[model samples]
Target: MKNNILNSLKNKFEQTKTEEKQIQQYFSTFDFASNEISESDRMFLVEKEQILIKQGKVNSDSLYQICITLLEVSDRFKNNGERKFMKWYEHIGLNKDRVSELLKRAHLYINYPEKKNLISSLPTQSVKILTKKDIELKEVQKILELGYTAVMDIKNNITNLNDDEKIKMKSFKYFDVKSIQKIQKDIKKMDSKEIFNAKKEIEIYKKLLKEAEKQLEEKEKDYDNQNNLKLLEAE
Candidate 1:
């Protein structure tokens, strides 16, 4: 029964027009295979930190929430700053573990700060440290290159596919022909700005698909209800 209620709520939320738009926007920007973050991207991190500092020292709740938001946004781009943020967080007197956990829930990475003082106090040395800028950029470049290769492989297979195969491919609508076409176009252009735009567009499409699925589920439920009512009347 609890599951049913939860499912119902999910269906309703998904069916809403606003939810549909939000989902479309989300998928349009989806870049699942991109590099998380590099050291060169430190400017982004610095900007975020500045925002936190500007927020002024408030009650513990507000401070923690803002920190979590900054951490969450950074993590979404694969630039997890939980450890560094936590170092500063503890310096200001917050629940280190709870804040760390919350950041994880928001899809950020978890690590212990590299500060010798923090390390000495920690129970374990196995904790991963944040990657430096150069290391991070290299990692990003490698991941992007690998993503390009995968896209190429999929493109080759897709081109060879017959009508039956193409129809079967609809099961993975997120990677449909249109998406592949855009990807190929971006590759040909070989511009970082264009690639970023293309990636954002793909994310939007995925969000739209999610919204459409939700709407379809709601319609299915309504249809089921009408059929059930008719059957009861006939009986």
Candidate 2:
């Protein structure tokens, strides 16, 4: 009975692995961007900016960073403020023109807070730049976390199918040889720029995965054939 249970569990595990492989194969044709931006990338940029800012030599790159940070904060505040503005506008039944004006003012207020008077006076100036930089870094971190959540959701969706169900779905879809050929032709003819981008991304990921697998295989082989004799001699 224990042996039977173990075999059953092994079979289930193999089935799951097969299903995941099939799902990956289907998406193998689809290309997606790397979708990974390391925390180190952001930290390096922050450090570079800090050096330039401290020197009080505002280069175009530093200015660009400042603009991007402001834009990100402005977007966040605008989105939140718009929701609140809409609610109040509906509650008060404000005139359409008045509401529009209020929204414009709200955006300006959010993007350019009254507290940062010195920074606003000289937007290009880098004095006390660390405060703004910290805010931007936090926003970038939040955005990265949100992106990770989205990727996890996609991964969950892809891996949720059972082996039999996946096989059946693939089989039924490709039942007629002619129909399968036509579908392939249609996919070939699909001209969306996004599709092309996805295809490129998929190829890149496949190459990366291939390299990783090769390295793993080499490591496994090395482990299996490790020089135990040499180790004993050393001891």
Candidate 3:
């Protein structure tokens, strides 16, 4: 009986491994950006994107493929214009902002196909920030070396600081009340650009705080209901 169970488990594990390999192969070879776009190819890309979204487990490689697929079809969706591709992405369960980000990254990757491995090595947020405008490969490397806080500073138009100052900015927690108060006290010392960036950070924090409060309130309600059900069951 033990031998039979062991063989069954081994077979299942192998099967799963094989399936993963096949999926990876498919993504690798898929003609995601073919010039000769046919209806079947279009549908294939759409189905793959839908599956990726449904699985809710998108890593960097899969995300890169998704961007390529969207960038390809986007041209045909809105009178064959990529600029108007925003409406169709909503149908595929992506918000406008997310679709824009993916498209920008795709454009950057397509423009510099040689740097794909380097691009893929970075975080998705970092990639999004890097691709917001026309940037050189060397510039991307420089910003990456400076680290996350520096990248965020660039995102907010805080460009006057040196590398050390940019790196030091990461020490403060964006959502900490005490940190915000300290920043407030030091606001008078900041340049105009730094002031603008700080205000933007505060605005983002306020939005996040509201979202966290909402989620917490919902969880508390769920906890209370679960407790009430337990009390009734114990009666």
Candidate 4:
């Protein structure tokens, strides 16, 4: 019975592999960008995209490929291509948000081919978190080590925190003394005008820092008062 089950699973895997190959072959030959491409041909691609989406595990690479194709097809449409794309995308019964995300992932895949291995290996949500506008490449590599759920949780927690808490959480990273020193050290390379601009910027930053410190002190005092009230209540 176990052998029978194993053989059945093997057959199903083979069938999927065959289907993927045939669809990919079709994709390669089809002039999806041609203005003359029929509605039936467009629907064929849509059907294939739906099949991939409905799979138990949609591979990141396949999803990105389909997104790229869909966008390309949309561009090929002479009139209201974007509108047509949206109509087809909705017809596939996918979330518009999800479509936006997949397109972003696909663009990231194209733009950062060096990081393609890392991006393609992660789930869509993890990719979304890692590719945030403010997340640098080093941070992406570090969080990639934590795996999908951890990356998502870390970003979600950061997002959910209050402004003060967010600032506190990222304070260490934001205040990289070494980076500051590097900028200071590079000041020697600046010409007079550049140096003047840098000095002005430094003054502005100093004022900002002083304001932040004052606000922090106020918050700390409020926190202490809250703690004291809690202690009195307990008493």
* Clashes (N, CA, C under 3 Å) per candidate: 13, 1, 0, 0
Q: Candidates sorted by TM-score, descending order?
A: 3, 4, 1, 2
Give the per-residue lDDT digits (tens) of candidate 4, residues 98-177. Answer: 56665666666666666554565554455566567766665655454544333325464443334553344346854766
Best by lDDT: 3
lDDT of 2 by residue, 1-235 (tens): 9999999999999988985675444322112236354667655555555554434433332433433443454466575586654564445444344333323323333454442222222211112221232235343233223332222222223333345533444456424455445546767667798578657866886688567655665664354223222222333
Q: What are the models' TM-scores? A: 0.26, 0.19, 0.36, 0.34
The better-scoring model by TM-score among 1 and 2 is 1
User: C-alpha displacement of 90 in model 2, angstroms?
Assistant: 76
- Model 1 TM-score? 0.26
| Stretches > 4 Å off in candidate 4 | 1-60, 74-80, 135-149, 152-235
Best by TM-score: 3
Model 4: how large is the Cα RMSD against the reference?
A: 22.5
Q: What is the lDDT ranking, best to worst?
A: 3, 4, 1, 2
Q: Which residue window of length 10 is worst by lDDT in model 1?
A: 121-130
The better candidate by TM-score, 3 or 4, is: 3
RMSD of each: 23.9, 29.0, 19.5, 22.5
